[model samples]
Target: MSHYDVAVIGSGPAGTMAAYHLAKKGISVVILEKEMLPRYKTCGGGLVYRGRRRMPFDIESVVEREFKQINLYFTGDDKVLTSLRDVPVISMVMRDKFDKLLVEKAKGQGTEVKEGHKLTGITFGAISTLHTNQGDFQAKFIVAADGALSPTAKLAGWKETRKLIPALEYEVEVNAEDFARLSSEVRFDMDSVPHGYAWSFPKKNHLSLGIASTRRKKIDLKIYYKKYLEKLGIKEIIGEKAHGYQIPITPRTDGFHRNNVFLIGDAAGFADAVTAEGISNSLWSGELVAEAIFESGLNPEKAGRLYQQKLEKDLLPELHTSQTAARWFYGYRIIRNMLLKRYGDFAMSLMTDLYIGDRSYPKNLMKTIKGKIMEIKNPLM
Candidate 1:
């Protein structure tokens, strides 16, 4: 049996980030990926400023476009455009190239990336054993970064408790006029879908248009996607097909670690409920798990506890705050519109700060929102 210090399942940003850090620290790490390198991943591919700032290496080579402003449209004529002036708020890149670049960086740091190796089973002992299509391997620690519907977490006896939201993305090749017009800014239409939103992220030669909803089973995403495209005046430019996937809207409340096994990124349900942004949290969690393992001296029990402590102190609090804010922001449309109409710039600035890691979601967000609602009701106040 091939033995290593850590075994990471999946080669997305989360898994690669963990493996890169671990291998750089001289730990033997192996990444098992079910698909071959550079496989297409269906995503809007917008890397927000927060996620970009957290990356250890420059991803300039993979970045296709950068935008300094975002346009938020609530209804037909209700909209707000927030500009960062000199700071780019989001960078766009195709996932296939982006993910491959991260994996290559990990490889340079000495992590063994075993492509096309799907993990079939896992047996726990003093040292956990991962049964894969390639072969069985042993490791002192296991990191599951597979994705929203994580097989590793299920195999490890963890329950599926996080809320899974549906999303659809289309890569459309547009004419010069539309491409040039849309490429200058990122646009989001909140009223396009029920309890969800539609977004347009511009890449080098195409636009990644997507719609997502937190409300389960009640939405026809395809119908909404068509409406969103028409609303943007680009329905005719849409490609032949659209890709769909599920995103975890919250973190796992039970726990993130069991024995020597740790779940990071979507596997641990780390995507933000408000924005549905996962790359930043995914990378952050991956780095944290690696740090915990190193701090624990490869002791699984100690590492698990340390991981939980780090999560509660740093990541979980933000996620919880976002969850509360999302409930209010999406639940009451009238109140939400009122708040947005009155404080659109302030709201957008707060969100921008959060995305750039300059600020966190306020712990007393609900109270603040309630106060705002009361102020709106009493104009004299």
Candidate 2:
């Protein structure tokens, strides 16, 4: 058995990031990954600007493409809206490359990256024992950054409270003509998946297309994806890879940590409610958790409290606001269409600001929406 200050489960963004920070502060940390590095991960692979900017090191080496412009198609093609930022609005990446880069950075910070160590069980105590496929290891703290279906969270006694939504993504290679036609910009088609949206994020040589609905009900994503492909005029198919997963847009009602085990990222359901984007918050939460433990001098209770405070100040509040925005943005169809048509440009800019980490969600969102509805476009209505 080996012992360390912290043992992290999984090497995804949250886990690797936490390990990186903790190791930087001289905490002995090891990341036990179930699979080898550069493994395929199911994601749309669109890293928003804010997330890219937050990285401690440049990720240019792993980046596939960058776009400063966004094209949003709402309801009908006629209702399309566009926004351009001076900085890249979204950076494209393959998770395998992206995640491996993160792990390498953490390793550089003195984190031990133990690939092929699958966490089978954990024994809780002042110092917890982590049973892995390779062997048993012990640590004073554990960071559960495993992802949406976090087994570590369950082992640490957390129940499901997150609002998990279904999403389907495909890596598609089209003919030269189709590739040329769609490869220049990033686009999202709203109302294509009922309350959700469909996105086309162009990679260096292919397109990562996906659909996600915010609604909790049952729907055929394949059916919607077929329609979306038709909508994109993608008549020829070369090769495609498909993946289906769930996004936890709501945070867990249960506590984030117990017995020195802390949950971050999708394990704690920190993805944005509106966008269902988890990487930004996941990275943020991982850093905070590590900071809390380091600052608290490894005091379990104090670290947990500090972590909660950090989240409440920034990440949690935004998630709450995102939930409110998502309710209006997705659930209310008529208002959504109307508002998108009338204020699409404004909305686009607002989202752009949020994506760039320049602004927070408005305080009185519903009030502002009401004002917009009653004040403008009087002639048409």
Candidate 3:
């Protein structure tokens, strides 16, 4: 039997970020990854400025491209282009290389990473034992960063309470001319899908094209992907099979920790409801858990309480606000279009500010929306 102070399951951004921070703090930590390093992960691979700023170290080596502008398209050719000329709005990177980079950084800081270690079961008590195909390991604390279908949370008797949405992505190889034309900007077509949106993200050699839906009703994502490709005028050029995955739009409200175990990232369902963006929140949540654990002096119970408090104070408020915003943003297309039409620049600027960490969702969002509506209704005022 092997023992460690903390065992981090899943070596994605959340796991590696937690391990990196813990190891840097001189805490004994180990990372268990089911897949080998540099394995491909299905993602749009778009990193907004907020997420890019959260990374402690430089990611220049893996960044495929950066964009300074975003195009928002609506029905009937109504389009708004928002540009931040001086700064990049989003940075792109393939997850395989990016995740490996983070893991390597953690390993450099003395975190032991065990590849091909899949956590099958967990027994909880004062200390928890993790059963894997390779062997058994013991830890005083466990952080489940194992992603959407978290077996760790299930083994601990926690049922999922967050909403999981479907997303489909494709890496399409385009000719040089088309690639060059699209590689400079990011596009979001709001009318491409119902209760969701389609995205065209430019990479170095290909375009990461995808669509996602937040609505509970089942959507044929494959069909939607084909339509999106046709809309982009690239259906004939798409070179690979489409990849699909589920994204959690909300976090578990009941709790994030139970019985000396904690959850972060997709395991905890910490994705942004409005954008389905998980990387920034995942990194932030991982860092927060590490901070909470250290602040608690490694006492698991105290650490769990502290983690919840930190979330309430820092992370949960924004998530709640975003969830409310998403309801209106996606729920009522007429009102959404009205607001966008009247305040397109302001709305886009506010979102851009949020992405760059300059602003947050309004705390009193309903009140804010009411005020905006009044302004639109009485333009003379």
Candidate 4:
């Protein structure tokens, strides 16, 4: 069996990010991908500024579009909430290109990716053996950065405890007339789906349109998507490709690290609770785990503790606060609309602030709501 310090399953953002950093630290790391490189991945492709700022290298080469302002629309509300910034708040990317570029960066740092290596099972020990269709390999640790349907997490002894919601996206090419009318800005229309929202993101040549909901089942995403197209006033379509996927809004309850295996990104359910965005946190978690392992000097127990501590200090708390906010925002629409009517732009802007990383979700959401009702000065901060 080929030996390495760490074996990372799946070459998505989380895995590639970890491999990149670990290799930079002179650690022997190999990424195992079940598929070939530059494969198509289902994603909305919107990278918020908070995530963008953390990139160690400039990503302009792979970026399709960048917007300094974003718009939020409600079903009946005529007034659109707009948040503008001097710097681009969101950058669009096609995952095929983005993932490939990240893989190249990791390769530059001495990371090796063995494509078409589908992991079949794992035999755990001081040195674990990864059983893949291609061959078996031993590693001191394993990083499961594979997406939501991760077999690696299961093989590593994790029970399925992540709250996965549904999402559907279509890479649509509309008539030139319609594209011209719709391609200038990034917008999300709330109330377009029950307990969720629909978004129209402008890419280099087409629109990445999709819908997602916190409600797990009994939701017809296509029906809502059809209605959304009518709402957008599209005259004709030139081409279209639909991709349906899941977004994990809740982290797995059972710890992220076990038996010398570490989980990051969707495998650990690090997507945003309120917005269902995950790229940023996936990158964040991968970086943190790399640091944990490096700092622990390859001690599995020490690495696990350090990783847990890193998550608890920031990522876990933010996710918890986002979950509470999502409940109010998506689960209870009446209260949200009422507050929107009163606070108007201020309320939406506050959430956008959370999106742009200017301010974090308040530790005490109930107190914040009460302060708003009491009309306390600066209640809408």
- When superposed on Cα atoms, how far off is each prediction in RMSD? 1.2, 1.6, 1.2, 2.0
**Candidate 4 per-residue C-alpha lDDT over 1-381 given as tens digits, one digit per residue, 9 for 90 to 100:** 799999999898889999999999999999999999899999999998888888899899999999989999999889888888877889999999999999999999999899999999999999999999999999999999999988988988789898999999999999888998899999999989999999999999999999998998878899999999999998698999999999999999999999999999999999999889999999999999999999999999999999999999999999999999899889879877877777878877777776677887788987887677566445556
Off by over 4 Å in 3: none
C-alpha displacement of 293 in model 3, angstroms?
0.5
Total clashing pairs for each candidate: 0, 0, 0, 0
Tell me each candidate's TM-score.
0.98, 0.97, 0.97, 0.97
Instruction: For residues 165-265, write the lDDT of model 2, one tens digit per residue.
Output: 99999999999999999999899898899899999999999999999999878989999999999999999989999999999999998778889999999
Candidate 1 lDDT, 1-381, residue by residue in tens = 999999999999999999999999999999999999889998889998889898899999999998887878776655664758356788898889999999999999999999999999998988889999999999989999999989999999899889999999998888788788888879888867888889999889888999998787867899998887777777457354589999998888779998678999999999999989999999999999999998999889999999999999979999999989888888888888889888888998898888778889999998999999889999889
lDDT values for all models: 0.89, 0.92, 0.88, 0.92
- What TM-score does candidate 1 reach? 0.98
If both were scored by TM-score, which would come out higher, candidate 1 or candidate 4? 1
Number of clashes found in candidate 3: 0
The true-versus-predicted C-alpha distance at residue 236 of model 1, in Å, is: 2.9
What is the TM-score of candidate 4? 0.97
State the TM-score for model 2: 0.97
